[model samples]
Target chain A: MSLILKGFGKVLKNKEILAPINLTIKVNEIVAIQADMEHMNAFLSLVEGKRSYITNEIMMNEQSLQGCEDLFIYRPDMGEYKRLTPEQCIQFWCDLYKVKINIDNVLALTELTHIRNKKNKHLTFSEKKRLQFARSLVQNTSIFIFQEPTYQLDLQSKQVFNRVLNEILKNGGIVIVFTSSLEEGVRMATKVFRLNSRGLQEVELGDEGEKEAEVKEDETDSLIENDTVYQRKFEKISAKSDDKYILFDPLEIDFVETRERQTILHVNNEEFYSTVSMKEIESKLIPYGFYRCHRSYLVNLQRVREVVVWSKNSYSLTLDKGNEQTVPLSKSRYGELKAFLNW
Target chain B: MNLRLIRVLLLKEIKDLIWNGQVAILFVTSILMILVFFTFNQLEFNLPGHSITMFKGIPTTLSFIVLLVTMYVQGNLMVEEKEQNTERLLGLIKVKYINVFISKAIVTYILSYLLFVLAMVIHGYSFENFITASFFTIPFFLMFLFLGTIIAEASSNTIEVSLYGWPIFIVYFVIEGLIYSSIESRFFYLFPNYHIERGFSLIEHGEFLAVFNYIYVPIIWMFIILFFLKKRRKNSKTILNSGFS
Candidate 1:
């Protein structure tokens, strides 16, 4: 399941806010948003689920494991609310030691409350920066871009953000933070993408600043390298969010990746409750009955419930869930769903 | 609720509320002044057209809540984002700014009215006859809030929005006073005060007030203000800079 972000850019309409003219940040890359007060809302519009002053009303309603993925970016009074204390951290670590919970689950902090207010509440500048950094670390998704992740933060918080950002990169993720001060950006980012008068450009960093991206000692790397299980688990790996992970486990996860003519079926969690890929689906369930319905979707020849006419020239596919999911019935697949499902 | 973003925005608002604590103090003081119209120094619900008087106070509280909070709170919305240069940050993450706005209004209302209610309670006022059923003032409250937010968003000078909010206050007061004096007139219908009258009349008659402010003045004015702000963003390249209030 390879997801691609085609074209994304940000343009500032104010002289008060000078941005790197135009830039494209892929998924999983941590890209920092840097600007003064005027551009904050515009930058905020990028992540908000609703229409904002910066952009149009397009929204991505998917759930992200990154803590507080749905939170508005510019709330100022957030500190006045509440937070889980340092003591809470001790308690959490104790629980983790006891349960041996996966780091991913713990990082999500699903039950997080009071710590994040639905409305704006009071917070110090440092607190906000720290939280943003933590969010970057916990998000196990495609590319991250932090726009000035270290602005107005106190010293300790800046250090913490820097550490968390490095951790994100070390975890097989990409991160890019924006800064007017090249020194700051150079210090913080691993892969710096500059968006000055020139369209978007990229720059790789040398060893400098916080070394959080490193695995601390040679032991950690050797532990994984020497472990036969870990080696066998990862073969040909590609990009991943929470939903789509490439074939990492060598033996059990054999796949053929090519831009080929073979029909590839996509199984998304939204309409496709059946988590099996088209090949797996074709083997055990819908044998002799699957086709690449669309570029981003698949259909089981045996389970399609209906083909509702979409327009004079197109149609939609309804499935076992009694839910209708659309697929362009290009003059090609019109007769496929019905004859295949035998309905 | 992302703790980071919320913390950033919330901190700024508190800084603002405190910086302009004078507005809050003045607004509350005005409410205290209205306590003069009380039937007696002591608490009593006895008076001819008692419902009428009580009905009017409902919108008054809402409008004042909207007015004063707007005076101090409107600038706190997307203003800082416009200033600190982070709106595009918000856009990139795909945040819901309206929720931020609504949440901000809610917090402001809760804090302001918490104090207002405490003042009322301290003075032996009773919630028993409060606007339990009438919702007329709700639209008026929302209209004021949305319109005020729009003005704050579009203001040329950021400092003037908070320091000299009297212009906004004066316009609202004049409109409210005229509408209040002629509740029966069609002119007041546009004032949101008219809706307050209707809602209060129903509450006085013991009817259900609506639950959706989204359907009332709040919703209408919210869309109106949002439209203008969006329009301004499109019409002028400097629109985003002007929003830094």
Candidate 2:
């Protein structure tokens, strides 16, 4: 089944709140739409049929979405029966959806089995979010919509959500995520779309071009010789964006490339400008399995999913970050990458 | 209209009430009022034209319990969902609003009647005309239930319930006092409290047929409140979609 929206838009007081959007989300496909809070809510309201649209049409399997809402399960960021225990909460949802399933299995899937008897009000924020995920899981609907599913969750909670998301997709369920964070969109979905006043458009990941910059040979040779000792100096790489500094773990960096003489660290399709030179950053990251695929690109070997050959001398390495995330692979380094992997 | 859905919702309401400490306190207050009234009747205080009998005052006591428990419990039931945002989940699940409303009304009705029976047993009153008394009180209970729903729908939280609920609760009794003072006015007939108090008085005199005469007023008030409840719910949906929390 496919969910289709054609020219869907909202207007209030003769002012366009959301521009007309058209998209089709097919079964077993995960799609994410990133927008500001106002537009996100406006778009969600339009889809949920809570707000009237000046011009729009939504259909699921060629049926109007107006009266076929039961096929969709919306898991908003906020909303839970705080007074009910996790088990009771799941039971209530099961009964409401008229489905019978093993409640314990769902609790364990959400990692709330340890606190199955705990009231939702007493659970932590992440636990509550997992419980919400469990509630939607029991409904067993055809389509799932999530709003900021991992907004403030810890690493462990995010993994749990990813597990549930995989379970749904494996069962042929269509998923749509609405978030304000682009990184979150790319991380959770294969097809990431951005909704703004300009309307809906798919975001092309890893399409930014890189520029070569001269690196001093003496500085790189010295760091490469003592890379083991240099690796022990720091465990996090510091990058700057706007007025704030962010420290990212080496494992989180998908790849790094130089653009216009500035080193940029790419993590989950987002770029952070780095002050360290390419030679020093590559030496520091070499021990962590980073390969200098090109003069302008340093690719994390652990995140490389496939090596694509465009021609004899033209090649690119696809990183497993999201759809179409590829970095330029220099033909000279192709033999080295193969030998490094023992191919 | 779905029986299974109604049953599931009823179970939810029952469990929620059991876990709520505030509602438990309301139940305890009712028991305490029963004991207090039972003791007062035992003393047999006799003054000319001021004698207090169990039959004469029991209806007034039950009416108070009905209003207090129904308003506080029903109002909290609705407001707590809004405060916790579970109402939106209910909407997403496609649970009919009528199903939730019916479940709450049934719970409130059973709780009020149980307290009324306990009050009668403690006061040593007979169940000879209990069915007639129950019929006379049904409309009043419904009136307060609808009124409580209106207040809950208009309120965003429990504090707002008290803010708006107490004043209206006080007015019900104040109006009852005015009607009882021999102040002849058709305006008094507009209030459900007048019908409730007058219906109970008719029951005390064994005027069962006359009790029905005062029932229509509360029924009319209930329909009016029901209309307002529908309108308030529509406005609430507007507020929800407008992102005007």
Candidate 3:
């Protein structure tokens, strides 16, 4: 089933929550929407059958929201409330949806087989999230609306969630992910929409050059050459400190970390402080071979030597230079970093 | 209209009550309260050479018991679903809200009636009195069950429901008692159980038509409560839409 929002506008108490939005989503398409937390929640509320638009059209499978079977499945992010074990919860969902039981496959897929007998309330946040996903897999739902599915989850558990998302997409399900993080939008979506006070707008991913159309003789060849030229331009970045400045090779920097709101540049044997915030530095350096490994640390992709999993959810990245300088890696961004490294 | 779904929901309610030990608590308390009140009434009023009327004190005791059990069971059901946020799960399908509401009312009514009859049996009321009195009293108790549902839906948690439900329930009886002695206003006719004892007295004397004036008051209260519930449901939906607490 496909979803189409045509001039969809939502208003609450004389204040417009969502301006007129025009978008069409196809089956198997994973659309991630990034916005302020409040607006994001309002949009999710509409999607999950909690609210309806005041003056617009929303159609799922060519039908309105009311009595639409195609919009049957909506799982809000709620804490575990059932007194039953995870295994029983999965079975109950299967029975409720009148689907066949595939408990073993669900347990194995979520890596929750070991804790299958534990009551839902006793499970950790990630475990409970996995149990919810397992329950969803047992039911036959055409569209999956996930509100902060990765919230408060470790990187490894996020990959488990990512796998579940991929499985849903593979089965031609509509996946709508709502988050407040732009990194999450880049990580999960092929297309992203931004909701702000001004209204909804499409967010273009990748280089500004890619967004423009070139009327060259060879359009395909020109596109390839343009990408390579864009890549060559970001080989190095300059920084300033104490009335002195340096045009340093970005590859020579092992990592850039933020401490106490100060952005510190980390080289092999030298450190330079920048007045710019980490977010400012990140935007300038991301086009280069730099990857944000954690909220505090951004590493030069060429300097990363090894990916280490110290524990189930704890991880670190070892740099190739400076006696194998170690940098803390966030679990939330670990999978994206590994994918960027192709490791 | 889906009988199977209604059956499934009713069973779920019963299972939840049983698992939570509410049913057992209500059952044992009802029997014990009956025994205590039975003995107390006999000793206080059944003096030497004087005949004690079984019906004298039964209505008041049963009314209080109905209030307690309805708030306990129906209130628990309402707050539990809202607390756990499982109410939305039911809305996932095409089930009518009316069906859901009626199903809960049916289950709660049956449980409350069972408690009443069990207490009546232990109090040693005659079968003839039991049959006729229950026929008139069931509607009055059903009104209480509906009010209990409104209390449950209006409140957020178990503690909040009980804290609010109990005071209003007790105050209702107090007002009714005051009205019975001091007021002859028609506004008192708006109450569900008003003139219930008088209606029963008329029934005992075979004055059947006079009972309609008493019974019709509860019918009006039912419609009024249902109207209020429908409006509250709309308000809750609006609150949900706004995504505010």
Find the candidate with the highest TM-score and give its number: 2
Model 3 Cα lDDT, one tens digit per residue, A56-81 = 37777766655333454445445444
Q: What is the TM-score of chain B in candidate 2?
A: 0.85
- Could you say which candidate leads in lDDT? 2
Candidate 1's residue-wise lDDT over B121-167, tens digit each?
A: 54444454354522333444455455545555665444545655677
* Residue runs of model 3 more than 4 Å from their true location after superposition: A11-16, A48-56, A59-69, A72-123, A154-157, A198-297, A300-343, B1-4, B21-28, B45-57, B92-95, B125-130, B175-195, B198-214, B234-245
Model 2, residue A85: displacement in angstroms? Answer: 1.3
Give the per-residue lDDT digits (tens) of candidate 2, residues A239-300.
99899999999989998876546899998888899978777788789999898887667889
Scored by lDDT, model 2 comes in at: 0.75
Q: What is the lDDT of residue B242 in candidate 1?
A: 28
Please, what are the lDDT tens digits per residue for candidate 1 over residues A139-208? 3354454555555564456556555654554565555455653334434543454453333455433232
Candidates sorted on DockQ, descending: 2, 3, 1
lDDT of 2 at A148: 79
Spell out the clash pairs found in candidate 2: none
Q: Local error of candidate 2 at B96, Å?
A: 2.8
**Higher-ranked by lDDT: 2 or 3:** 2
Least accurate stretch of 10 residues (summed lDDT) in model 3 chain A?
Answer: A208-217
Deviation (Å) of B17 in candidate 2: 1.8
